[model samples]
Target: MAKSKRNVVTHGLSGLIGDLLVFRQRAGKTIVANRPKPSVKPPTTAMLKVRGMFRKAVIYATNIIQDLTRKAEYEKAAKNGQSAFNVAFADYLKGPEIEEDLSFANYTGQTGQKLVASIIDNFRVASVNFSIRDAGGDLIESGEAEQSEDGLDWVYTTTVDNPSFAGGVVIVKAYDQPGNETLVQVMV
Candidate 1:
């Protein structure tokens, strides 16, 4: 190890090291060689072309069938006096919207440092949870979050007291109380 004015340097291999060999023994002789197992080759151009043809055919047919089914359902609903907004609302009730914008302050934090997370989702978020994990995947700290008044934006501010959280992984799990959970992971 060597230390400089601003940083420390360590000299070592940067990746995994391994060794493998093949050997064969005869009646009165032995032979050895550094022979590795053969690896599988990639798909050829013809294979890809055939795969793409079948893939496109299947997807096109499935999309057309689904479109027809949805159209028929909508037509039946319209004949029953359902409004356009009702159809849209019915489609929107499938699941909670994704949280598009998730920002964090002080991603690389020290002990007792304040960490803030701001979230913006499409619908009302029921709850949010944050977790910090060490390099070995051991949880350092975790807890529920606090939401804003209107619930469109969520804010989670807490003191990072664990010293192992400075360069660990940060996990954000947000839910909309509809049994749907949105997860995002980031390296701190």
Candidate 2:
């Protein structure tokens, strides 16, 4: 790939000039590259699934930009030269993620014990849900976590008391504005 520098004809040009070269604009600059060759092999199942997922992302972005309220929300998250539709589309493709190595040391199956989780998303995390299960996989408690005032962490207060929580599991699910969910599990 080469950057177009002060070339009069191709300075702001985009699209293919011929079958040999392709020109595109990115980050307020024109880029020139060789035309990509069409794949000769048949699409694999994984590739088909990815294409379907991207199609859904496109539909989601279209709906989001059409709604004034949601569009404004995404626009606020967009950076310079980035559109709300692009942000929404990228958010749809990349779901929320729960930071690994979450600290569960404070949770001891006590009624008032608290668990804090850090969730990362491209745009915004709408909510976080936590579920506590026993060693036998029996659900002990489940509830929605409250987002911190600074909007960095989610805190969940334990409701049930189980002395035998050492071998139990705590599951956390983080959701984004696009309804994408990321689930993480930690052993108590």
Candidate 3:
């Protein structure tokens, strides 16, 4: 058995529509073509009109869906406990919105003990101030609280040695970066 030669053959088309083919073989190269064009109907004005109608329909559908979603969100906010249900851009720009959602959780302290409070903020809390008041509404001790490790809450800790923290009230004030403050009173 003998190994055949690895011959290279070329059968490529030329011109814009690839209608012409250049052939190569043992007889050399040749170029001859009488390609017949296929019949095709050119795009008409009706086709363009249909395409424009489809585009308009798509745009109208998208806009209606967006409007419905926006209205639903606005209504939900209004129904809920949103203080400023009016979605004015100017109101949002006016300083930081006040967050009365300050809450204390898992607080473990007593009178004459190390009064430690956990304060949570709905928004960005910048500072947490705590004050121990007497029964007569007099301020006995006031100081800023410390932030926790999780960066989510503020921790207020102080010694209840002033004797005002017994039957008195614990005032926790939370301030956000937007210059909004919230005060909460907790009974000792």
Candidate 4:
């Protein structure tokens, strides 16, 4: 048997070919063909409106929440920083504004100890003099020296011309030990 050629064509919107020979030759059997009916679809208006509204609401709410979070975080950080600075400043002020001197009289040893009484400046020393006199008013010990800012305290002078006080003053003349002392004299 010779194989037959099949042709399929359509004209206009709808057309049908009826030939038992085509069906038998192509599929080897009799077949019925039918066009599917059009399906009905729901309207998109309500669904689209609902989706758009929810999307806009979510976007707006997200932006508002983010802004609020950022502002709150900034406020918290500023409060923390301010508190820290306050604490630090309070600590800073707790110390003495001007450094002062500590003095002691009758410090032990043959050499008399000089206690600083005042400060001239932050670094410069003040011209100071000390004299030890006996009960007879005789100069038993004399010294001219520059002391640390606090006049009572004495530091070694860079100038070798620093005067020396007698190593020891006799107890009988001790009444004159610190008498007539010019503790500090600042040069203008």
- Find the candidate with the highest TM-score and give its number: 2
* Candidate 4 CA-lDDT value: 0.34
Instruction: Residues 1-188, candidate 2: write the lDDT tens digits.
Output: 44446789877789997788998898878887899999999999999999999999999999999999999999999999999999999999988889877869777788988899988899989999999999999999999999989788999998889899988999999999889989999998
In candidate 3, list every pair of residues with a backbone clash: none
| Predicted candidate 3 versus true structure: per-residue lDDT over 1-188, tens digit per residue | 33234433323323343555433234443333455566597868998887775565455434433576643543444534442223322122233322354433323344333344454433345687888777788887788877778875565666545533456777877665334566778766
Candidates' C-alpha lDDT: 0.55, 0.91, 0.52, 0.34
Per-model TM-score, in order, reads: 0.43, 0.87, 0.39, 0.22
Better of 2 and 3 by lDDT: 2
Candidate 4 regions with alpha-carbon error over 4 angstroms: 1-104, 107-109, 119-126, 149-152, 155-188
Off by over 4 Å in 2: 1-6, 18-21, 24-37
Q: What would you estimate as the lDDT of candidate 2?
A: 0.91
Clashing pairs in 2: none
Highest-scoring model, lDDT: 2
For candidate 4, what is the TM-score? 0.22
Worst 10 residues of 3 by lDDT: 84-93
User: Which 10 consecutive positions of candidate 1 have the poorest summed lDDT?
Assistant: 6-15
| After superposition, candidate 1 runs with Cα above 4 Å error | 1-105, 108-114, 120-122
